[model samples]
Target: MTRNAAFKVALIGASGLLGRAIAKELAGVAGWTLVRTAHSRRDAQSVKLDIRDAAAIGDFIGRESPDAIVVAAAERRPDVCENDPALARALNVDALRFIANAARDRDAWVLSISTDYVFDGSAPPYSPDDPPSPVNAYGRSKLEGERALLESGAKACVLRLPLLYGPVLDWSESAVTSLTPAIVKSSAPLAPAAVMDAWAIRYPTFTPDVAVVIRQMLGRHARGETISGITQWSGDEPMTKFDIAQRIARVLKVDARLVAQRTPADSTPRPRDCHLDSVRLEALGIGRRTPFDSAIASVLARYPEPTQTLKSQ
Candidate 1:
């Protein structure tokens, strides 16, 4: 079970934004077999499993008995988490606990996705060892999940990332890409300008790149090297949502009138800047940061914009 030439892995939350990217990455790997799971959003490729249910998680993990487990399930919306901390804790904290504890029996390596929100944006660049001071419900729940895994005694790695944008079935799938609709709407004649926040700085990392990092880490683990504890991966670009909107407009080749709100207007308090240093993963030679503009273009290409948003040939 420890060192197999090939690996069987279970991917929880396979129907979500990050899960889809990870599923695609695992599909392309040579010697990896994946059992993808879905909850509210069911798909034929994935089995139905509500990760929030502890007994169900135990039963599923016990029956499937995979060599590794990747947890992508989370209530990532800061606003939603702020409004309903209970639901956030249920998925982000409790579900992760069930997973980590279940995996302990099989000694399966557990890789759980975490976020930059764990740190209060004041820090310029946070390291794995940096103490976390989560400012919002979302961050607190995720940090608790990380702690739960650590306490579970299962071989685990908490991979923390920043704002992510990549191939999306819809723009709203990612916080960074969600600005597209408003930016596109602004292109119409005499349309109201699309205003974005210039206050909070975010490093928009690509989901596909994160997926590759997981693959690399799992490959290393399968090769008999134990990859445990906390690690981070993120894009080096530093831009606000307003700046990101402009880039999205540029990719659409549109003359959109976009406005930037210099002040923080979110109901939920946001950290001004929480940049994560990628040195840890970079040292291991396992990470990628596709240029923001180019990556955005690729994502936009996969999902076409409304006719009004497209430029004339």
Candidate 2:
């Protein structure tokens, strides 16, 4: 299909952290129209297209005829996916396939946002070439989605983002938001998980940076390239849950002394070290990774008040 000068872009999950940031970035660009998705038609300019419904998606594509499509909707809760694998697959894997096929049919470029959970945590600093060995249901479902996109032969880019933090546009509370208050309260005596053995490192890119990268990729000429979006952090950098907590506490001016460190065996099954190397992204002229301390400060700057303490065991 011929490329259009004025690109019409469709973002599937425009309300989420990454999606919203991307939408904001795309909003400022000339010759780019962002069509955000909603669950219903009450919202103007939003097509009520559920990714799970292939027919609806196909129809939406034909109607909107966007030049680029970005799929960011997914059941991100790992434990919830484990409880119901079918639903997870439908949203994460099958839906992605439907979108990929639809994008291919319209000759539009597709970008799917993914996670670092695809790794089994056995290795540190995972490269894009590393074979995924997911240990949990969420990771498995995401892997399936990635495979479907590749197999469909669509012009696609799968970006594996590490932990992300940004300003809260909506007051919607999530696990990350819920834990921030507690971290702030205990900043004075910061005690975080001291799982030196349980190592999982990530660049933790800011949401705005991720959005800029996506915009660059979509506007660029490359197709069928998968890149990892992470910073250059080492697994042996003495990182742990405690280290992160301590940093957050420091940034937010919480009582670091109150922070306690512990390692419970029943914690979530995560990779010991899955820091992604963004050598490919750097080469592509995308901005460098955000500094870890700067990222933590940004998070704290958003939530200055600690109304309640995070329940610590």
Candidate 3:
């Protein structure tokens, strides 16, 4: 199905960071109507549906009968998922299967948002074909979700994204507000642990740019394509966590001299690098990846502040 053709589209997780951005993109476009679902009646036109409730999802699909479904919701917090593995599995894996099945039953196209965590992060700038070796529970669950969807024999596209920063619909209750404050507060002179040698590269796309790419991919002719939604930052220079923190400070014009370097032994185990190579998307003429500096500026521009920063004890 093409964008020019009128079709009904259902977007799950419409209240999330990426979901909200996708919803905004869909709103301005023609030939598509946004069918939003929430855990509760958060807004008008939103149906009360939890992804864990497969029966409810099936019922909703039968009722709304959208031509396409975008599964952009997932339990994204790694620590939270580690604490509640069952709940995470129910929502991230099982729920995705249910949505894929429903879309298939209705002969609708499916586009599910995934994450770069599917990889173990041992390799830098992972391509779409890289073997997944997830080290964390959250990563494993998301990998399971991707496997379930692919194995279902449905026409689906799994787009794996990196750390996302974007403007939220409810600014007062947005992920950025909650996370950024903690990030800023935690920004202090690097401690022994803070300088840990752990490393991970993130594409960190702007919400607006990612939303535009998703719209183009779904509304255009890229069905059955498993694309990576990360930008190519130098194609070789992988940014470490310390590097990211330093850059964040620099973009905000804050004193980054105190941002110290540490080893992975001081903190939790994390992937050293997981930057994605978006050659496929670029080849398709979708959109180029936003520069790291440019993306940071965009995020900081949306949220300027003298907020309390979180300090790690």
Candidate 4:
């Protein structure tokens, strides 16, 4: 299908951090009819369709018969998924499986969003072909979600992502953004002291960059090209969470002190470092990777300055 064919596309989770970026990226682009859906936070502009509801998804797919479906919805928090495995599976795995099956039946394609947490974080810089050994419930559920979608025998692509940050309605929308307030809350605009896992490594991804990558992949798919199976995409630099926090403080011009603290001896077992090697996407010539600092600057530039600084805890 050419771009001029006016390809019908369904984008789930259009109100989310990444989803919102993707929606904006695709906006005003010719030859795409976007059908957006959300669960409870439905805006007047979006359709209310719970991904967990299989029958509703099936009905929606049948009615819309979109040429492609992009799944950006999931129960993404690790702690939340760890506490409620079933809900994670329902949202992360079952919903994707349902979409895959329905799209297959209609000869449509799927682009399912996945996470880098599929790895156990023991290894450094995982490749696209690496065997996934997720340590947490969220990772396991998402890995299964990937399996379900790819094994459904549909023309699908699973883009494994890293920790994402971007412009959002609030800082709580992304962990990276949530750390910003901690820095600027001091009376003297000093960066607040925030504890970070010194040993854990992460490659932060900007949502706008991810959106561009997805749009490129979708464009390829629309042009009857093969951009299927699993691929890794992330920012260029690899840094620890503490490093990320410090970078945030630097970019925001806050003198926040980011403490490099190791994970507690008795704390929950989380992946130490799941740095994804994004060579697959690079080889395919399909990503707009921005340097971490520049990306942070661009994202923070969008929002207003911080409000009255609150007393640090």
- Highest TM-score, which number? 1
**Angstrom error at residue 179, model 3:** 6.7
**Candidate 3 weakest ten by summed lDDT:** 304-313
Clashes per candidate, residues 3 or more apart or on different chains: 1, 20, 15, 2
- Model 2 segments beyond 4 Å from truth? 1-4, 40-45, 169-177, 185-199, 222-239, 257-267, 302-313
In TM-score terms, candidate 4 sits at 0.91
Runs with alpha carbons beyond 4 Å of true place in candidate 3: 2-5, 168-198, 221-237, 265-268, 302-313
Better of 1 and 2 by TM-score: 1
In the range 1-313, model 2's lDDT, one tens digit per residue, is 3344566889997766677678788898887788988553214545677888999999988888887888878888778888899999999999999998988898777788877888887775688888889988889998898888878877777888666656554323333344555555443344452222223443445777788778877767333343422222121233555566666667766554443334334345766657776667677776545666775566556565432222310
TM-score of each: 0.95, 0.82, 0.81, 0.91
Model 1, C-alpha of 181: deviation from truth (Å)? 1.2
By TM-score, highest first, what's the ranking? 1, 4, 2, 3
What CA root-mean-square deviation does each model show from the true structure?
3.7, 5.6, 5.5, 4.1
Tens-digit lDDT string for candidate 1 (169-192): 667888987898889899999999
Tens digits of per-residue lDDT, candidate 4, 36-69, equal: 8877666776889989888999999999998888
By lDDT, the best candidate is 1
Error of 3 at 273 (Å): 0.9
Q: Higher TM-score: candidate 1 or 4?
A: 1
Task: For candidate 3, write residues 1-313 as lDDT tens digits.
Answer: 4434466788998867777778889887765678887774246756778898889889999898877788878888877788899988998899999988887888777778877777777766788888889878888999899888877766677887777766643333333333344345455566222231224454456777788877887656324343322222112235555666666667766543333444454233456567777777777887645676776566666454422121200
Q: Report the CA-based lDDT of candidate 2 relative to the real structure.
A: 0.68
